[model samples]
Target: VWVRGALRFSKTPNGGEKLLAAASSHKCLIQLEDVAAESEREEVVARYFLKQGVQVIVYLGDITKQEADALVNAANEDLRHSGGVALALSKAAGPEVQRESSDLVRRDGKVATGDAVMTSGGKLKCKKLLHAVGPEKDKAGGRERELQVVQGDIIHEKTDVIVNSTGFKSEPAGVSKAILTAAGPPVQAELFNGQKHKFIYIHSGLLGCKEIVHVQTDQEAQATNKTCKKVLKLCESKGFTSAAFPAINTGTNFKKVEVDPNSVEYQDIAKGFHKTAKYKIHKIERVQNYHLWSGYFVMRRKMEMKNSAAELGEKYLYHGTSAESCHCIERDRFDRNYTGAHGASYGAGVYFAINASYSANSRYAKPDPAGLKRMYVARVLTGHHTLGDSSMKSPPQRGDDPSDKYDSLVDNLQSPSMYVIFHDDQAYPEYLITFI
Candidate 1:
């Protein structure tokens, strides 16, 4: 038989239609081999699967022969085999597929969340049937639980997945089904919305696909670049719109350094963003933790490293002179930077880096002098809207005279700041401060 411009010939002495007829019957192990003059037909089929975003499951051995309990079906409550794997199954099982699903839906009206229906294996080798609702936003705009049910079953290992007739409106039937297929049964079945569900973990060998990469210094920056490239390739391969990244290799991976204003690492993943989808960077940190303080300082030290993936207009230029020693200290202080009164203010924006011990006593301990500049800038930008250093727990009395041109610069109140406060003087802390 020919479909989508691909010729199909059966291994048995029969026409292509006979093979399709056998598939429709769901007859066990209808093995067939390509008989075209060339393998162009096979290429066409592969391209068809790709166009639809379907993940073709190829096992070295028989899959259906394996014994398993429940088989999970990605079925619409409508029970009509419409598109995706559903349509494929319906075609394979003849009309019996629709008959069974229709019978179940008749009894259930519409399946509720976490609901299922059982059916005979029919032509397929499996036994009891399960019809669970994947996530869906109905026509009325109410949330449905389709994803929770399908995802849950896919990850169960005990259950085999049979996805069918599911799709998002914006995608073609094949493409939507394919993405859902790739997400696997776990994400498909698991409910990740308002309700709570059991935590099911599956190791797809993609580094579990959920990990944090902490980067804190120039050395750490090198490692982070490599990781970013690797992650970008992974996402590209997967056709994902975006991937979230935690500041990688920045915490435990870099050398220790005194935290200072010049130490923040803020490079953009420009390479990852070149694709149609935008990538995001999630800075995961523990506030008020001691070890976090050290890592934050280390990252700040490496912020200046040239990033291979930095986006255009995303890099920040630093022109301030380094003040490593007391003797070399020049025009350095928190208030001085905020007022734009002392440092080279050509166009440097403000950044905060916190490093400290997480101990309660150490939490409030005074920050390092070098790192104090970051805290000071953050405080000025986020907390108090003063021209310079001033307490915000209480604002300047309305009638209080503008003591100086600096005090007169106070604009609106309640502007937020990004300040990093580390508690440990000698080591990184467990938490960093984000006082706004």
Candidate 2:
């Protein structure tokens, strides 16, 4: 009988189809010859599996004879039951599977890499056999792997739920822009009506995904962390079996927010925003835990190498810096609320190197002033709007105050780890000192 492309199989007098028919019907083995042409490729695939610790044992005998739980077919790009192993399996499974595989592939493209299609074993010994393409075709491997961080298009994720970050007022432009844009007009309409930061919103038919979740939170690192925590809780509450978080505040792309600064979108959906209401994250307990962990484990080592680090421990009592660009000389003392007279600002985190150098500032501070372990560990937290040393030392900038001009020039941060604090005759620089 003709099969696949019909190259003609003249060796087996009984032919593969007849043998597979009997094997499927009787649930018995059908002794057959080796597939000389494709044996090398089969070995390669098996070797790949074996290297992954799968303990694969390739059997050259007919697959229909094997009584394993299931058998797999290395299908062509189209997944059709032409000649080769596919024809033998299909003939054994009866003619119906030709239609099954074709229709399924029609509905879902050629089974791509890291993907598989299942079929009833016809009359074969086992109940089912799976056909899959290998990772050489790594198209959708991202989904096949468990949870991972990727730096490409978020819209392509096939997970159950995708998390997009937005604020009470609106969805920022970064990944949120891509999400809402691909999500279509309905998602935009929904965003215009409410401040669902704490709440979750669901939409359909935007992307091919099963569902989309919009998380409202600040774009800051800690804020994104809080949004993630909320998304996890929402998943549990809604009984979602599986979920995925497309890069949130930090998207593979950039962040651009679209909001009618005066429109007040949240006014209608929720009672959270007003004309000038700023976004805030209250649940920082987890953030504190993380900062503390980084402080004790990661940053603590850096401090241990410093000569005068003991002095810091004695006065600040807390000398840990979370890797999130945070530099803490003293714990519990980083008054994120430090807004001195001239409208200067300081965040809960600070960015500083541990080099203990008298030099102004440097991402990699020069050879340690002392015999400290001069090493660059990570970026300390910066970007708190702290007006340079002048801001820390004087009153807030008033109109005609050159401090504003200096503020413009204030602490441009020569290095990734540059910030200025006051200097007492007895101590090191006291950065982030919003108050005199």
Candidate 3:
């Protein structure tokens, strides 16, 4: 928790915007040894060398022009390299950066807020590039008023219940300490008043009309989804309209994920760490009718579109044929100009019924949103024999008879194993399975 690097760096007024600009623009080439020598003697250079971890070294410098083991690109949810660091890294690393980033997005869904991915660096000096989607940034003056993020001592929160993260030998640590200190000795006594299980929901007079939910974790480093879900369900069932959750994991685990507080990755991890708080809060909102915000707003939009398709009396994919298909129409006319209309699926290999919506585009098919239906190719898998020399680009050439080639292609298509491929971004949609 203590930033030893900051105190050593801040002792002298070495860091500022001006210094960073000058350091980056310096024409003189500095070698690794020279930088190292300087760091040993010069305090500023020493500051540049941040945390010397067991495996990783966190540094503060121009990421665009740094000699590192790997550089991370703060990517969009779709893993597109856009403006700022993303754009700079793109220009430095070239097209392969975007391609590899795309592949990761293709395999996995939109990179989660805290998830980190590694890809080839392309033209960059580093050995690899890490792509991660940071949490959505606060938009304009809207964020502060919304109060989605609350920072301070957890004990001070005047809510329905302040969630006490108690797990792995609970005496008093972190938020538990603050809560016990604030709420007189009676609250602690009430917590243990015949609490049989890990999840203890106790009514407390010390913390006013509120109560306390002391939850035991999975005893692992990270809190599981089940644990987080339990807390939320308890809040709704108990009718605690408002709840404040402290940081879940503190002293229990021997390991800690350390990152620079100012960095994008760190912020994302911090947001991820407190995801329980966000999840629990929203569940309470829906239960108490605190607000009319939907948890699945994006899906709701897709449902509206599906309803539009249903009204047109279009045949569902599974109705006549075993296959189902949907073209991603432009959500609005304004979205027509955009390319890279990626496609996704609801199921792993199959697109679920609900998956017909926007998020279903796993392949990121950049279809003309204006076009009602794009050309989807009928795919056939090679059965029994693998085409060792086949590229599937143009028909096999090299003195092969035309009739033989045609017969082979037909045979592959007719094979029982040769079924249609789903959620494949690389495979162009040459055959139309239309709803309209």
Give candidate 2's root-mean-square deviation (CA, Å).
22.7
lDDT for each residue of candidate 1 in 26-57, tens digit (9 for 90 to 100):
86455444445334322322322466687554
Ranking of models by lDDT:
2, 3, 1
lDDT of 2: 0.44
Query: Each prediction's Cα RMSD?
Result: 24.2, 22.7, 22.6
Q: Which window of 10 residues has the lowest lDDT sum in candidate 3? A: 283-292
After superposing candidate 1, which stretches have Cα over 4 Å from the reference?
1-69, 137-436
Candidate with best lDDT:
2
The true-versus-predicted C-alpha distance at residue 32 of model 2, in Å, is 45
* Cα lDDT, all candidates: 0.33, 0.44, 0.43
* Lowest lDDT block of 10, candidate 1: 311-320
Candidate 3 yields a Cα-based lDDT of 0.43
